[model samples]
Structure formats: structure tokens, C-alpha cells
Target: MEPDRSTPRTSSRRGFLLTGGALASTLTETSMAQAATRARNTGDADAAPGSPQHPVVTRPADWQPVAERLDGVGRLGTDGLVYRATFPRYDLDLSSYGVSGLVEASYAAFARYPDGRTMLMGDVVATETELQRVTDAVQAHGLEQCAIHKHLLAHRPALWWTHIRGVSTDPVALAVAMRAGLDATATPGPRDPDTAPPAGLDTAAIDAALGAKGVSLDGYRFSFARAETISDDDCVVPPAMGVTTSFTFRSVGHGSAAVSGDFVMTAGEVQQVVKTLRHGGIDVVELHNHALSDNPRLFYLHLWAIGPAVSLARTLRTANAATNLGVVTPDANSSMSTES
Candidate 1:
């Protein structure tokens, strides 16, 4: 399952936004668990992934000052392991038709792996004008762009999404580089925390159609996540932060929704998952990985479509069935903090 390399995602200023961000032709799919299969490149037997695991570090606290430098608060995840910072996209007023900032914000999670190296991974919400600079900054600062593509097919002001990953002993330097790319965009500072949006769509119907649970977010979108337990450098990273199979539904009125989000899959499953999406009338807009060396070598398939909400959900359920996934039920204690 090679990324469509022929479809180059060049950062050469002029062609950064070309497609190949995702690899899908046409297909459709549903279900709970797809068989688990590992993806290995036969030709590249000596490929090197991001980094190796290491012993415990002397500085978990080292990440704090870096968070402050980014002007974002760093939270010690309740898991007491991963350190995370949120950079909300409050700057883009997706509200002409009402898109939630929760849906648009960019964030990165860092973990001091048992292997001693700290790794950072996150996404940035970029506009056409800011895309190139942000891309340049991350690459310049030693961070890698995992994916660059759009979320909404028809959005006002037009926004593009870029997924980034990096590993270093100096977490603050990684944060500094991340901040540099962010400064290129108009993405605003964090706002007073907002409540999950009120729902206008038939929530129960939507959940049933998708075969998974969802949360109401800012009356703008319904979101769900199927998390895969993945790790790097001998440290554990939660599903919500980086590698979750994410789904979002925004009401288009009369029970229809504008659906957008990504599916995390192993290389072997890409074509099948995409085939299922196409069968359901969904568009596979972007197909790429979230990290350079995720243990299983995961790929994220970003999709978009507008239709009867329940019908789209069911098709998503079919596509979900094509991946190796754990059962992702709604958390009764789940809050909107994981909104993105």
C-alpha cells in the first residue's frame, strides 16, 4: 500500500495542495472489526522508522516551559503520561454556515517514551495563504508533514489540514518549530472554553447509521472516534491524541449531514476501505499517515460527503468494518475537550 507518490504533495510553494494527500479510487464498505493484518514493504527491508525506544528521562517537566512559549497551556493527561497543548482555530470563523472552533483547532501531543526520546505529533488547520509557510516552517524546524489536504469540500474562506510528526530530546525546540508554522496562519489564540455544540440532527438515528456512538459539538457537528492503541519509542500514546479513526457530521438540514473525517488503517486495508467508501457515495479526498514510524505503519483516509445523515453513517460503518479496530463506544464521562 504505497502512498500515491505519482500524486506528489510538493512543498515547493506552487504545488503544496495537490491531491495524493489520500489514496482512493472508488469503492464502498460497513461493520465492527476488520481482520487485523500487518503491512510490510517487501522491497524496503531496511527502512528506518521515526525513532527507537529508550530508558526513562530525567525531564518530563522540561515540556512545561515549551508549552508556555507557544502561549498554550500544557496539560498532564489524566493518564499521567502524555503532555499535550491545544492551539484552537478560533481565528477562522467557520460560522457563515456555522463550523465549530472545536472542529478546527490544531494540537500536538508529546510523550517521554520509555526509550527516553520524546516524540511530538499533531495537526494544523491552515488556509491557502498560510499553507506554504506553515509547511516550510515545519520542514525547516525538523518536523515532518504527514498529510496536507482539506476537511470541508465547500467551506467559506477555504481551510486546509496538515498532519505533522517529530521526535527529539528537546520537546521545547519541537514546540518552537510548531509555533513558527502556526504564526504563519491566522489561527487565533485559545478562547474561553466553549460547550459542546447543541444538536439539530437526529442523534440516535445518526449513531445507528454509523454503528458507533457520537458526541454533539457546538450545534455545528457530531463527532465519533475509533482509537487504535499505538506507540513509539516504548511509550504509550492515547487514541484521542493522534491515531483515532475520527468521524464528524454537520447537519445540512432535514436529517442530512456534511460528513468529514479520517479512518486509520494498516497498509493492507487501504484499497478495501476505500472501495467501501466509494460504494457508499463517499469521496476519499486524502490518504496518508499521521506519523513517520507508527508501530503498525498506520494510514489515515480523510473523507467527505453530504447526504441523508443516517445513510452516510451506515456507509461509514461499512468503511469502518474494513479496518483493524477496537470497539469504540461513547464515553459517558467523555467531555468535549477531545472535540478535535
Candidate 2:
């Protein structure tokens, strides 16, 4: 063997091929075993700790009883805070609607100077009857009127929005009272299925702009964000008023969409918002304060725009940036300083 060092190894071609094949088969079997083992482990992961199916059970608290009794409409939490419910109504027929009278009364009473002080704040639609009922209700409940306006236009029956507020130790009592006023009106309940979705605008674009993930409601889609801070008589607001800003997009057909949303802003941010919307060709239908004595004060603006939903959303983003509005805490010092 030493003498023949230069000679080639003596394995046949077939033998070489057979050896290579066997090695390859061994590798393949090993790989497959590993893959199957991994699959089994993955399947077993369901029984592992912290798995979704084996979620930890939490003990119920006594407060749950009180919360259930409230029908979840309102709740008093352990933090010593009382939450209130806000109800908004839309109707196509305001004048002949039974609730029209109540709406008008509430507005009128809210507008009267003396009534304004006790009531604190309220809002109304433009229709004469609606305003009258709202004013009257404000007077009756000793609540205040804050603004009168329209949330939408060319809506089937005619639409109006009223913002009302009152302060009471017993928020539930207040809600019950408010319900009585609402019951007096023939405001239609939720829309019927037969009621077709509002026609118009590009549905897909609107969906993309809103980032709405849920199913559409009556062909209209909506997104809502909660106010960053609420105030109580110039201090940190307790969570009593269900204060939230909602953005809604309606399909207007032919790739056109209607964009409208409520923005909750502080005094300092109002001018910037107005300017931004104007620059974007959006209309600021109404800009006014919603609360009278709230600490840091809050203002609500009703905005409208007609365009592609994505474009509208971009404009909204710009407008939102102009104000100290977002999920994160705004520069507190900056926001307060700007308020001056």
C-alpha cells in the first residue's frame, strides 16, 4: 500500500454512488425526525403555562354586583370615580317627530341666561322645533346649554346635534331624569334593517382611512378615540361624562367619500386646528366650548370634508398633530402655556 501511494482508491462507481445515497438518506431521515419533533412540541405548546386555552381564572369582586346593577351603562369604580353615559340621537324627520318638542324645549331653556348657569352646558340641532324642545328640557332639568349645531347635513330627515351637561352628586339619578326627557320624544330607536345604508362615497377608501377593523354598520363606518384628559371644575376630571371623539366616514359613491368627525381640543389647539383644516380644504362647521368650568377647559369642533377617505385621513392626521391630541401625554407645560 505504501508503495502504491500514487494509485487511485479501488472503489467502483456503483459502490461510490451507493455510499453517497445511503448518507443522503440518513441525513434526510434525521431532518425529518427533527421536523416531526418540532411539530409535536408545537402541538404540546397549547398545554404549556400561560397558554390562551388554559388562561388563569380571576376571582370576581363584590363591586361586580353593583356594576351589573348599573346595567354597565354607568359604573362606580374602586378609584372613587363615577362614570356617566352619553346618548346621541339622529333622526331624518325632526319637525313632526314626537321628540322634536323635547329637543326644542331643552335648547331654549339652555339658552336662557339664568338657565345657562344652572344647567352648565347643552347643544341643539338647527330645526326650530328641535331647538325648542331641547331648550325646554334644559330649563326643566336645570341643566345648561353649551352649543346648538348640526352633526351632518343632507341627512335623510335632517339632523341636529345637541351637547348638554349638568353636575350632580348622583349621576345615575341625572341619567334617569335625562331618560325621562328622551322618552317624551318620538326619536326613532336604532335604524331598522330595511333602512338602506346612506348612499355615497368610496367605501374602501373610507375603510382604509378610518383603519376600521369591524364590520360596517348600516353601510357607515366609524372610529372613536377617548379624550386624553377630563377636568372637574378646573382640576383633573373624574370619569363621569362619557367624553369621546368619534370619526365617521360615509360612502358617497364614485370613489368620493364624506368625512366628518368630532375633535376634542383645548383652547390653545383650536386656532391651529382651524387653520390646518382650512388649508386642507375641509370645513369647520362649528367650533365652540363644550364645558363651562372644566379645569383646562375643553372645546369640541364639528368638521366636514368630501374627498377620498385616505386623503381625508391624511388631512385629519395633520390637523390632529396641530393640536395636543393623541394617545400619549401631550407636553403638559407646553399645552398649558399655550392656553394663555
Candidate 3:
């Protein structure tokens, strides 16, 4: 009886191993067969009608019409983005006033995103009636009004700024609507195009320092800093806002120059950056947010200095190093059309 029991136990162990091995083999076969079936289904779907291969809608040709419409409404193209056609001021006092008010409105408008279509708008206003007129016009245009803050401390006629935005498949249509809003405000005085550089500045050396192509305008030769990290929230940022730090040099004459431009930074870096710029003899004008949900939460500080352009560029490079930013050139596929 004992011998028979031992034999049965041995047979039982062998049977369990055999069953586990067979079950494992069966499961593997089933998994492989399911994967192959899924692959075939995916291939069949790609070959089916009405896929991305046969899209349902057509895209527009060019955004030129949209640009023209924006222009018609008193919006000017600078660098690429359409800005409202308004008087330009070089003085920190006046420019600050304009930028402050304009930036406020712009931020407020942009906050309405997705559902409302209108996001941000910018304006320069004085009288209460003028403000109302601008607001009324903006609402009529289906745009969202975001902010109205001051860029400068002291200015005549009390200048103010407004920010505005809108979402639409038709860019031209958006422009036309915006134009109606601008028509309500007073036309800004003509900007002086002949502002002279200080003197004795070496523009060539400055350009070389910046290490990028330069463009001269209104007595100042400007070098665009390489595009760096952009953010939409507190995460890594993309380069959609055109939030670049430009270094502009004004020849002080005889190899000397004055430099000025904006430096984009995060809230955490503001104090350190301001100190750094001041140590380099740069004037900090305005520090503010240009967007609501930029991941890294960017802050822009408009800075100025009177020095050699090259020296200014070097100083700016030093400031650039204080942040987690790196120069980057956009790729071809990265360029997207704002078409419907």
C-alpha cells in the first residue's frame, strides 16, 4: 500500500508540470494571434474610405488676406504678429504708459479663450467716454476685453492700455471686427522716425557680440536674441508667443553705444535678474506677464542702457545665462499655418 501511494504522488507532480507548460504555450499562442489580428484590422482601416487620406475639409491658401484685414482695422504687422496701429514712443515715460495699459487689456481679453473665441486686446485711452467707446466697439466685434493698465508713471492726457483677442477660422473676419473697435479711439500722434543715437558707438562690434543678424531702425541697431525656452504654464514652453529678448544698440558715437531691450524671465528669476541687470548698468523699466497660462509663467522686463552695442550684447548674454534658457532654431514642421 505504501509503495503504491509514493508512485501516485510522483505521477501527480508530473501531471501538474505538464498542465502548466501546456497552459503557458496556449496563452502565448493566443496573444500572438490577437496581435496579428489587430495589425490586420489597422491596415484595413487605413485602406478604408474617408480617413486622413481623404479629409473632409479643405484649408485656406494664404493668411495674407487675414493680414490685410487686420491692417485695414489699424493693426500693424511687427515681426509677424499684428499689433494695433498706434503712436510709438521711445522715452521710458511715454512707452511705459502705453505698454502698461495695453498689456493689461491684452491679458484680460486672452483669458476668455476657447468658448468665447476672443482672448485679448490692447488700447490707449484717456477719458472715461473714450474708454467706454473702445470697450463698446470691442464687444461689438465679438472680442474679449482682458486688461487696462498703465505702462508709465507720468504722462500727459493720462494714457491707458487695453488687451484683446478673438478665435475664428477667418482671420480677415477677425481683423474687420477688430477694426471697428479701433475706429472708436483717437489716432495716436505720428512717431518721430529720426531719433538719433547718442554717439561714438561701434554698431559692427555690437552685432558681432549678439551673434545673430541685425537690423537697424530709428537710430538703433537691434539684434534679436536666439529664441529660447517658452512656457504656457509652469512646464516647458514653446516658441509661439515670440517672447524674445532683443538687444538694441544706439551709437553713442566713436565706438560707444547705448543698449536696451526686453528680457523674458520666470517669476522666480525676476529679483535675481533685476539685480544682475542693474549691476551691469541696465535700467529696468517694466516687469509684467504677457500671457495667462504660459507653462513656465514668463515675466517680461523692458530694460535699457547707454553703452557700446557690443558691450550691451555681452551684458545681455550674461543675463541669459541666469535662467534655464537655450537658443533654438525652429524646424520646418514646427511652422504651422493659422488657417481654417
Q: TM per model?
A: 0.70, 0.54, 0.54
Query: Residues 96-141, candidate 3, lDDT per residue (tens digit)?
Result: 3222211111111111111111112333343334677877876766
Cα lDDT of model 1 by residue, 31-127, tens digit: 1121111111111223344333321212234455666767856565443344567666766666423544325667776655432345566778888
Cα deviation of 104, candidate 3, in Å: 17
Query: For all the candidates, what are their Cα RMSDs to the real structure?
Result: 11.6, 26.6, 20.7
| lDDT, candidates in the order shown | 0.59, 0.40, 0.41
By TM-score, is 2 or 3 better?
Answer: 2
Ten contiguous residues with the weakest lDDT in model 2 = 108-117
Weakest 10 consecutive residues of candidate 1 by summed lDDT? 13-22
Off by over 4 Å in 2: 1-127, 153-159, 190-215, 218-228, 238-242, 328-340
The candidate that wins on TM-score is 1
- Rank all candidate structures by their TM-score, best first, as comma-separated numbers: 1, 2, 3
Shift of residue 3 alpha carbon in model 3, Å: 91
